[model samples]
Target: MTELLNLFIVFAKIGVCTFGGGYAMVPILERELAEKRGWAESTELLDWYAISQAMPGIIAVNVATFFGCKRRGVIGGIVATLGMVFPSFVIILAIAAVLNNFADVPQVKSAFAGIRACVVVMIITTVLRLWKTSVADRPAIAIFVPIFALSAFTGVPLALLIVASGVAGVAIGAVRQGRGK
Candidate 1:
């Protein structure tokens, strides 16, 4: 019960504090859970982030669920998810109640612009870190470049691309192994 409360409080703090959604939450998570709590390393958290993104739900909730389950069990996952969403639920209600009146104010607009800028920087930093770790070899780069291009410039569905890339990577690894090198 005490551990469950602690999990709720921590995830609630993370929920209320994070802006720009899941992508922006990565660095914050790295600092809190990874560096400070020492529950996981930054790279390990990144792996969870990747898996969470691929899951069919909100990434933040998925991440919280992952951490919670890892810590305790299914009940912990439920508690953590509720904690992670509670703040956002209240905040959105409050914002929606007041935002219409101030939506056009120059000050509010400027503040939003600043927030967007910060979010972009956070996202870019995470992406760069992911790239550094993920695209380390020629085979990985070969997979990344075309996938990036297709995702960026073409109408290719990402699920297909991901599947194809997985197959390609496995095939490449098998070929290398067969060559005894």
Candidate 2:
């Protein structure tokens, strides 16, 4: 189908453009899916991000599958996943083939250093963009602070933190309903 081909091309573009990983893909995903394509809204993309993180795969691939499945069906999911992966597969292969020769070159080293810095900026942009929507109130702040602290400072597992945050949100919502305020 024409739609399927479009989906594949779009995902392939995303795959080629994203650099630092899933977190780094947030801005690009937001722009492409929400701003340009209208396939999903920003909040919906955030939901997909959360759900994908809890699932058993790379976040970008899982998110692509989610988008594809939503757009078409199971087959779309498969196509989108392949589209999202194929570019990275080829790029990594190429990089590996030449890394030994170029790894020590000053220009290559400087370029990688620059990329790492940009990746950090991109990640920060994602956090800032999501911050207003995610930590909007006192209860959210209450949940976020401790979770963030544990994540940054402790050896506590990430899955446990995610679970703890979910539980906290549920409990907070239930208590708020009980008080009727």
Candidate 3:
């Protein structure tokens, strides 16, 4: 019970604070769960982030669920997921109730614009940090460049790109392993 409450509080803080979405939440999770609390390592959090992004549903909630399940069981997953989602649900409901009146206000508009800018910066920082660790060799670079370009320019589906990249990585790894034998 105590652990469940702690999980809820930790994820609730994450839920309330994170602005842009899953990518934006990564750094905060790294700092709070990994660096401060020692719940998991930064690399483990990044892996969960990747998995959560690939899976359906909200990334933040997915990561929280994964952590919770890993820590305890189904109940932990439930608590963590609720913790992560509860704040957003309440906040959005409140915002929806009030946004129509304030949506046009210049200050509100400016504040949102500033928030978007910050989200962009946060996403870029997270991607750069992940890239430093995830993309290490030429084969990975080869897979990354065209996928990035296609995702940026073309209308190719991101899921397909991710799967293709995974397949390419597996093939590269297998070939390298065979050569070493």
Candidate 4:
């Protein structure tokens, strides 16, 4: 019971504070789960994020579920997911009700503009942090550069790109292993 409450509190805190969505949550997750609580390592958190991205759902929820299950099994996953989602759900509902009434308010418009700018900055920070780990070597760059260009420039689906990247990673690993042996 205590463990469940703690998990709920921790995830609720993260979910409530997180803005700009999943990538922006990465640093906060690292701080709370890895550095503060010792619940997970940085690498493990990264792995969760990667896997969560590949899965067909919201990345933040997926990460919460993964970590919750890792810590306390299936029920924990449910608790954590609810913790992460509940605050957002309530907030969004309240905002929807209010924003509809104040759609033309200058203060609201300015506030949203400011938030969008902050979101952009947060995303850039996330990209830089992810780059250090993801594009560490030549092969990583090889895989990253082309797909990045294609994703940015063309009409290719992100899921397809993710699959292609995974395949390339596997093929690279296998080839490296074969060479070593």
Q: For candidate 4, lDDT tens digit of each residue in 116-178?
A: 788677667766876887688999999979987998899997778887888999999999999
Q: How much lDDT does candidate 3 score? A: 0.83
Residue range 1-181, candidate 2, lDDT tens digits? 9999988898999998788789788888888888898998777777787777777889999999999998999999999999899898987798898765757899988988898898788778877887888788999899888987997999997777777778888999899999996
Model 4 poorest ten-residue lDDT run: 121-130
lDDT of 3 by residue, 1-181 (tens): 8989999999999888788777778877877887799988767886676566567887778899889998889899999999989898997788888776767899988998998888788778877876876777889799879988998999997767777877888999999999999
Cα lDDT of candidate 1 equals: 0.82
Shift of residue 174 alpha carbon in model 2, Å: 0.8
Off by over 4 Å in 3: none
| Candidate of highest TM-score | 2
TM-scores for all predictions: 0.80, 0.87, 0.85, 0.83
Please provide, for model 1 over 1-181, each residue's C-alpha lDDT reduced to its tens digit, 9 standing for 90 to 100.
Answer: 9999988998999997788778678877777787788876666776676576556888899999989988889998999899999998997788898876666899988988898898788767867876777778899899888988998899986667766877898999899999996
Residue runs of model 2 more than 4 Å from their true location after superposition: 96-102
Report per-prediction Cα RMSD to one decimal. Answer: 2.6, 2.1, 2.1, 2.4
| lDDT of model 3, residue 146 | 98
